[model samples]
Target: MAYVPVKGGEAAILNALDLVAEERRGDPADPELTLAQIRTQQARAVDRVMAEGSLYDPDLAALALKQAQGDATEAAFLLRAYRTTLEQFARARPLETDRMAIRRRISACYKDLPGGQVLGPSVDYSHRMLDFDLAGEGAPTAPRAEAPVAAQMPRVPDLVGNEGFMEPSEPPAGDPAPGDLTRDPLAFPAPRDIRLQNLARADEGFLLGLAYSTQRGFGSNHPYAGEIRMGEVPVEVVPEELGFAIEIGEVTLTESQMITSVKGASGENPKFTRGYGLAFGHCERKAMSMALVDRALRADEFAEEPRYPAQDAEFVLYHSDNVESSGFVQHLKLPHYVDFQAELRMLREMRAARRATEQEAAE
Candidate 1:
């Protein structure tokens, strides 16, 4: 009689999954907390959700966490899911960058602009140290104001516009509508809207990894941050009833312009071209990284030698999502007993045939 050892494999797998679930539930240090706690305590998590998903309701994100039972990651997923359902009431009158209510702004070329650059809240060049007092086991108190505004502020003007370095953009003839990426599947050689939508929801770790690869001589381009800005931009809509545009709300945004030096070719001037990046909320690092990657993707425009992996549009864009990558990788744990059994049978037959052949040769 022949015996197949594949029996009870399904049961074993089920038991293992159950064990893992039990362990997750039994952990004491991170006991199940409500979304309110996460919102109040884990503010960085809320920031990450808003930045990655292009949604800005910290409270709602917290509520989602509560519903998801204190899983911050799952809470972010829920927030993104909810965000997709909301209707876009109006496309903002294409933001006049000149009119931005800047909180923190900087430019690399000059020490100041027509309006001086303001260094708002930033950790740049600061020592990274943990303040343990902030983690006291009680409700945290708000810090006292150190100083008050005493002087009139100047506005930060556009560098390119002021210098007339680039041609001015032509104003659209009509009220241009934004491209809907969700309703339509992305086609090859995607437009800016589709690209931005994909990038907004991209996994931070994956983006960071690709960015690191570029820095390490893979599709590398020398890049400098021309400007980085974080602030509120006005959103406006012209209702049919109202003849003129009305300010509806304001959204926080981070914008980065990266300047890359490229050699002149084909009778072109040897000047720096720009790579643009923008994201919801104050995500300076992500914005800067995005600008760098965007420039790297435009290898042909720079007249640089194209490297295989970085220059492959499909490979770079397709694998940039954490949710998709994680799900596919983890799916391997699902039952494949039949396939394994078939492989085992094939291996045994091949071994037996080889032994028989060897014996026959000896005879």
Candidate 2:
């Protein structure tokens, strides 16, 4: 049988190829800055890599930019590329909140603590303004070799825990074998670890949008930042070869716990439950939003009706991935000629059968 090419197929393919080539060339006006230049000059880009990609290697991110010719988007892609190659040598001992080298810590409660909450690099309660001084050329040079900050710091005593306002958290259990979501398709009814791992790698924009939707009454979850902390957390790993746990390295983490007041149930006391969020690097907004969504998902425990889109675990978790969503949406544009032909034939047959039935009735 003879076949004809679909109209505009060749043009569509050519246009796609051209777009790919343009992206490869990057921004023509910038003259393709070197990776070293981006690393040294574009600190914000490096910060973005650490935040969105969940990898803390500034050097690696810089190198990736150099390789991709200073494309921030490509730099993020490279960081994610490196993330896939890493093997979980061992799960770290669950972080003791008391042990965190608190760079920035805040709690919304009685204003006093043993160690007062340090508000570091936070934009909280501040009016947004575009500082022209920051945008000016030839700013004062930042210090290159500052002395290292002291590691040991005083812990912020939990007011609620101390005053019997809140129940103390149970000590984390010893390392359990977490299911690998990368290796296995996420099974129905996932564990908290699996869900968290997925969210850590979720697209920032997607999570932000979903979180915003909840505020717009999609799932009206009243949330308050119980605590948001950013700091260096030691990562301990046990090597199979050594059979002993050792400190591999430390990673900067942002953790948020949103306190939500749930309605009292029959024979049960009303209490504040928490939604948890944590991510690599200093991503307060993402962490905060994640915590709110996490709490919202636990609707049954709260004894309140869940109305928000954020409360829907399947919808939030499944849609938070950019790569997955982008690929699936774009795949519809691929050659589905065979499927289309099958559908067309079925429609034609149905029309013919209907016409025949009408003719018989007339006769």
Top candidate on TM-score is: 1
TM match of model 1 to true structure: 0.76
| Residue-level lDDT tens digits of model 1 in 258-344 | 776655656765556666677776777777777766666667756677784655556767776555665688768666668999999
lDDT of 2 at 114: 48
lDDT of the candidates, in the order given: 0.66, 0.69
In model 1, what is the error at residue 321, expressed in angstroms?
A: 1.6
Query: Could you estimate the TM-score for every candidate?
Result: 0.76, 0.75
The prediction achieving the highest lDDT against the true structure is 2
Q: Considering only N, C-alpha and C atoms within 3 Å, which residue pairs clash in candidate 1?
A: 115-155
**How would you encode candidate 2's per-residue C-alpha lDDT over 155-231 as one tens digit per residue?**
22244445544434452377577766666777656666777766766777777777677677776466667777888
